[model samples]
Target chain A: MTDTTVKEPVQFFVTEDPHHHDGDHGEHHHETGTMLGFWIYLMSDCLIFGILFAVYAVLGGNYAAGPAPVDLFELDMILVSTFMLLFSSITYGFAVLRMDRNDLKGTLLWLVITGGFGVAFLYLEVLEFSHLIHLGATPQASAFLSSFFFLVGTHGMHVLGGSIWLVVLLIQLSQRGLTHENKRRVMCLSLFWHFLDLIWIGVFSLVYLTGVLL
Target chain B: MSDHAKGGHGSLKSYLIGFVLSVILTVIPFWVVMGEPLDNKGVAVAIIFILGGAQMLVHIHYFLHVTIKAEQGWQAMSMGLTILLLVIVLSGSIWVMFNLEENMMPAHEQIERVRNLP
Candidate 1:
């Protein structure tokens, strides 16, 4: 009976093998699954940001007799940081283009450049935050300050995470030399990086520009 | 499927177009706000929001490479759903909260009456 049961599965597998062809089938499934799974993750991340943005919109005007956005925000400084993130987005795009061409060195080069801009953006954010705190615009000062910090700080943390990922990816790509797996990793990070830039567009517009207008 | 398999990495021209469009979109808002080219605050705010929205679409198309054809249309579908949810969350919260603040808060006359009574 046991022999018959095992042989039954073996026959079924033999029939399926012709259609699946093991190697190509597995690779294709894995690739599509990874990409789709990553996209789903990004969508979920978008929701989280959406919630934070909602919080900011609700609480942003409650200065509690403290300094307001126009008092603390420096438009020129913010514009510089905005451009930093934008430049990083395009540079990361260049990295993916290089990867598609199988230019390992060029891919790594652009990735490093992207990382540089990311770091610069983070640095500017840190500077802005410190400047705010020094001027007594602490998050605890008011609802407005609290929500503002939470929203923009979250975006900054994402950039920091992406920067760390970029460094790790750089090491992996150098070691693996653009293997299919490494290429997949690059693509996922590309999505992540670009998605962050998209979020920043919302931040700069709603938080910085609109803050000044308010 | 072939194009999808390539992950729609976008071309040099596409990225450049996106970047240039983003710069233009971005500059106009900053210019409107900083330069105060428009006398009406309402118009300036409208320009900022409109331009910001436009730049976001550009980024999604060129940088992220999201399209109806990509990923068997799932990408675009998912994006549509997210945008719908976002609109509901944002507008709903503001509307509800604004009404709550308006209706729940005591009037100045009521506050003055309470203060005088005590």
Candidate 2:
């Protein structure tokens, strides 16, 4: 070999396991990363709800010449709404199960049912709020009403958002089929749906049920 | 395969269990409040709160799949931190507010008596 080109040792990056795909298994789909990010988001969401709850607790008993919880809260109405949401959460679980099984049609069917229940829940809440407002118990009526409206209204908004997400997801599921990315989206939405249900539990217990009791 | 190995993600059995428990917990409190099963308001409040707490655990465990095992304990860690913050925020707010109300707001009867005196 001609020694005319005496070159310095070439510097380049090297690795013993450069081609190892062990860590890059199914995780390349960004499933774990998205899940962790979503979880952090949910925790922050929890803080928001927590503060709202604290506000409700603080201002709950402040009638200020306005309607009290017992006067405004209808046990029957809230009970029905509670079941609507609880059922929706379970239906969402069914949808996720269908996703796990790669049954796109079944998933959509269950998601529709879940959305139906969500709509029913929001309807009941809207009706309750409207009835209260008609009876001169608007949020502007008193501190108690203000906190009640804000806390429950925030939760209702979340459900509305989830319902809209459900419609969009149904569209996505139809167009894209049950791809890995779609499945991850389903799981994330499922987490969100159930998280809302958890917060509702606190609301009904602390705000409504306990409110009437107190 | 990983999904299959990890328990509580989408199990039908767990969902059913959670649903049933949630319904019972909800119904019992409603009954206690509506029917006034116990004459004591405090007892009814205590029962409702306890059952409510249990039902929340059920939802967290089964529906949300928040177990000690999920995500290599990340779920539990985050959940624990959230619970701690919630307790602090909720209890602190309630305590401060209750004290504020006591110190600031007069009872209706006291107000009425003051009105008559003036």
Candidate 3:
């Protein structure tokens, strides 16, 4: 019995050390946790967007004789803005690739380009909104306009928040040079940026393209 | 450290593939709408929705890097649950509201009959 006990402790010692080392070296504990947490947050954000989409879907037909979607939505300009967002999504992907390679300068450059595209998207959106208001299709004009503005405006606000986060991350990256915390931040922001692009797919498809078609 | 870290992110080739697919997907819908090649509006709208959903899956795969293996499958699990809930919320609200509108709102003739009840 004593011999078996001694051998068992020896076996446990051998297995425990490698297992501990593997856990420490293979991945950072907090990094995985942070990523999972951020992902959960994004899923919750998705629910909010789902609600807004429902609101728009239900109320989109009540134009109150003010103006229909085709009359207000300029497909040409919207297509341009859609390209801006798609380009930004790719550029942000490039940035994440650069980060993976530890290419600091390349990552920053791609991020800057991504930011430029994001700004262009926002500018186009603001132009569209102002033009709509000028044309007297204000939110108060009809339930359709109200829901349209709310859904699309909420998406724009998310993009705006992401842009701000990107700027902050850029500054942090420049100062810290991709430390562990900065790397995690970059990864989270990457998720946010890409998620926004995903949401844009819905917006352009359902709100803009279908709106015009309807 | 970098090697293991790189596992989670996509390579340049993958990103390029996704970008190209996305561009094609996006362009087709815009073209269909602007060019009006499809005479049937319903068919055109269906095409737009299908392509848009395809593009969204592409983004989720390529950009988000979500997989059954990611985060020991927790990511995929959470995403699945969220999608289920999203579908329920969106479809439920539309269905209920549409039914409510249909049943509750009186027809013009019915309203006139009620007014003439005196």
Q: Which numbered prediction scores highest in lDDT against the true structure? A: 1
Model no. 1, DockQ: 0.49
Model 3, A1-214: lDDT tens per residue? 2222233333311221233224534335445677899999999999998898889988988889889988888889988998898899889888887877779999899999999999999999999999999999899999999999998999999999999999998998897675555667888988988898899899889888888887
Ranking by lDDT: 1, 3, 2
Q: Flag regions of model 1 displaced more than 4 Å.
A: A1-25, B1-3, B109-118
**Proportion of true contacts reproduced by candidate 2:** 0.71
TM-score of every model versus the real structure: 0.89, 0.87, 0.88
Each model's fnat? 0.68, 0.71, 0.80
lDDT of 2 by residue, A80-148 (tens): 999999999999989988776778889999999999999999999999988998999998899899999
Model 1 per-residue lDDT tens digits across residues A108-192 = 9999999999999999999999999999999999999999999999999999999999999999888767765577789999999
Q: lDDT of all the models against the reference?
A: 0.87, 0.84, 0.85
| RMSD to native, candidate 2 | 9.3
Let me know the TM-score candidate 3 reaches against the reference structure. Answer: 0.88
Q: After superposition, how far is residue A124 of candidate 3 from its true place, in Å?
A: 0.5
Q: List candidate 2 stretches off by more than 4 Å.
A: A1-29, B4-8, B105-118
Ranking by DockQ: 3, 1, 2
